[model samples]
Target: MATVKFNPKDILYHYCSTEAFHSIVTTHSIRLSSMSLSNDSMEGKMVEEALARLAECDKCDQGTISLLQAQFEVYLKDVDGFGFCLSKKRELLSQWRAYASDATGVAIGFSRDYLELLREEYLRQRDPFLGFTIAEVMYDPEDHEKQVRPLYQQIKHAIDEGDLLEAKKHSPLRSWSNDTETQRKKSCLASLGFSTLMATLAFAFVLKSEAFKEEDELRLLALINRGEIKKLGFDVKSNSLRPYREYELKKFDQCTPVIKEVILGPKHRSPISVVEDFLRCNGFGYVHVSRSAVPYQ
Candidate 1:
């Protein structure tokens, strides 16, 4: 076979986010610093002892630490200016590929199992008298609590009158609410027209529940007011909903180019192309592949 040459600088790569890229570099730098400190004559034993203690505190097994150390060495050798060389990039891509494959199966299985459990829970909590399902009550745009209050009042009246059997017979589970048809129709229309909007609102509710700092929430709110969130494809309707972490919001301001270079390996496709293909195959449509003009210094 003829001799082959490779140039590390010629390989093109991009990170999912600058923070992710920075984290990789910073972690490697920290490890390199630790290795240096532990190798020095005066601090060698002390540094090693400290590291061992810290590892023990973290509950890291020896095998895991050894594997991580080996990986870090490879990372230090192959990572370069805002990207990895071809070999390292390929290695990372392989890992991501494996994860992507496994994640698809796991996600499907989890969703199916969780949905069944949710349906069962809904049925169990449903009012026996109420003709409509609990899902309808939860998702109905109208004042559901107000609608259910009268039924509870009737049940209370029956119980107070010492007619326990009557109360049970007229229980929300046993009785059909008078407005079930109207409510059902409204729910159907809402599901048809505003399903995505409702889901987005629910996601915002979950994020707000995390109780992020007021300042962070205010910053995210400002971005919402400026229509930046809309630009990012989130249809956020309220300033109260802070749907992203501080670092995630910071990534929106980033304009780093996602380097796209031809791959020379067995799969002759660029890493970016491979990612695009994976996304498309998994039903992610038309991902934006952006490039920035800033030179890698």
Candidate 2:
């Protein structure tokens, strides 16, 4: 989890079925769905377990680790998250099979600058605690510790100085009741600074199972309290209603397209001109479209 630098010019690819692609172009939006309802049962919690194991390996103080662990549990109980996924690799085989429709799916390449800027601007007018981030997914469990160490140290240092309670007292969480704050002095709402908690949550959502490494994903993630439900929608998947939010990154006749390129899947039947025409009609004529080079059926 060393600092991975990505240029603003980097391209992140979103893969989807032809029907999903049509809906994307028609609606000019991407969906950020809830992680709680994800296909992978061990979504955010896998990283939590990894972080705990790493903490023990570092031989952190039993009291401090236990306290922080308890706080993490309580703090996360009320937390919910949403994510929009993209990949560092374009036209990837596994990505095609898992996310995109076999051969009929397509990949849209977006400007990293455009996507990040959109989130920043959108958050300016929203709550700061939304904890929104565009991040690379970490597959190695051993690397999970790097993402949480600084925050862990911050709490540990406060405990060593016997000022953990003092610091917690000063950092009053508006959501916490007076009695609750007093009882849970070392909890995230008390001892952990907002930045520390926000950073931890961001990494938690991105540190997924290594089994999914082939996806080479870069996710646009948001960790929010279940209270601030705004513009959220639900779709029926697997006979259950899953929550999602539409992120509007493009619009017809908008200033410019955030999409830089579109790669048609290997089995795409439409001619190049027809695809280009579709872009032109939708005000994204500038986006370059090419068929994927994969030799897949």
Clashing pairs in 1: 127-173, 128-173, 128-174, 129-172, 129-173, 129-174, 129-175
Using TM-score as the measure, the top candidate is: 2
Show model 2 residue runs off by greater than 4 Å. Answer: 1-9, 58-71, 126-131, 151-194, 250-256
* Backbone clash count for every predicted candidate, in the order shown: 7, 0
**How well does each candidate superpose onto the true structure, as a TM-score?**
0.16, 0.75
lDDT of 2 at 236: 83
- Go through the candidates in order and give each one's C-alpha lDDT: 0.26, 0.73
Q: Summing lDDT over every window of 10 consecutive residues in candidate 2, give the lowest-scoring window.
A: 1-10
Deviation in Å, model 1, residue 44 alpha carbon: 22
Q: For candidate 2, what is the lDDT?
A: 0.73
Candidate 2: Cα lDDT at 168? 43
Which lDDT tens digits does candidate 1 get at residues 1-297?
A: 222233333232321223333342233210011111111232111222223334455576784344333322322232111101112232233322332232111100011122223234334544311111111102221232233233323323333443433323343346434576544533442233233322322222112111211211110011122222321221132353223212110111222221223122222223556545643553333343322222211
